[model samples]
Target: METLFDSACRYMSDSELIYEITNNKKLVTEAERQGGEYDLNGLFSSLTPGRKKVATAAIELYKRLQSRHNGQDAIRCSQDIDALIHPFLWDLPNEELWVIALNTAAKVIKKVRVSVGGISRTAVDVRLIMRILVEASATQFAVVHNHPSGSKHPSREDENVTERLKKAGTLFDICMIDHIIIAGDTYYSFADEGRL
Candidate 1:
């Protein structure tokens, strides 16, 4: 026989719903959500009861995950990326959308690009990125591309895209972690470097 707790979890996961139980056991709905069960108890156990604020913790943890990353799944650590590009030095320039998908742990679930092409600036439709991130069901995302000019660099264009996407993420409640620029093996993190 299925237990009531199991049924509740199942229903919550399938419907992307979370139920908050009060001290008196009154159930309150927080927000609409997707993905499977989150270890809410385990994640929160370390916090003192007086400070265990579920909603606040979830948002902050999401930010912290993107703030500290190896860039291995999302980016590699060996290269700074900014030091690698030399668009003026090369005849053929290419662009790529670097991405990282994360779970509740703030650990990467996967990394991917939505598009890659010329000039690093030509594409990057902010609207398009919204769909791609949602399709992956990512709760957070980082956008990145190379300058090809070896600058470990971000341009005026880059800043604009980052801002637009950040606002979009906020609107959707999807955490916009950070943006990165990769050239060769080098990487620059927008959040860590404080550019974003």
Candidate 2:
């Protein structure tokens, strides 16, 4: 019976294997000694040389990109829901629903995973979605859930969820622009289909 902790450790171990470019075996050995609790730098220290600089550069580049969007006034971004989902929904497994919360301007303030259910059809409760949106103080939102079937078409359940969320968003004064279903490299958007 592997616990969640074990699963996380497994993911960490796999990451090490995938990114083992540096010969910083000392870092790996230390992390191994400590049962795999290495800080970002400590983990990076164990990488082989080329990967170290590459990884570090990647991080710095990401930081710069994040800085462009980090902590900005929400009133400026009013991004159409399709714009956000199109960039990230592809290739995700089904039963994983992610929400993009936005400020008044429709700019994304946060991306949250509100649920992890079955790979086929997960039960989606509207209240759970509402709760997170409210907690985040988001004024608008776009929802994206993967299908795992590699079909970007929305099912009846997906349509229902979108309608329900739209109605619910009205109550919170949060606009629900679109609900996207992503599978493999394809994606479907409710708004683009004139459903929203």
Instruction: RMSD for all candidates, in order, please.
Output: 19.2, 12.1
Give the RMSD in angstroms, all C-alphas superposed, for model 1: 19.2
lDDT of 2 by residue, 84-140 (tens): 443444444547787878877666678777777776787778898898899989988
For residue 189, model 1's alpha carbon misses the true position, in angstroms, by: 1.6
Q: Candidate 1, residues 118-139: lDDT per residue as tens digits?
A: 7655577777787777777778
Clashes of each: 18, 7
Please, what is the whole-model Cα lDDT of each candidate in the order they appear?
0.57, 0.69
Q: Candidate 2, clashing residue pairs?
A: 21-48, 22-47, 22-48, 23-48, 78-105, 78-106, 91-184
- In candidate 1, stretches whose alpha carbon ends up further than 4 angstroms from where it belongs are 1-93
Q: Each model's TM-score?
A: 0.50, 0.58
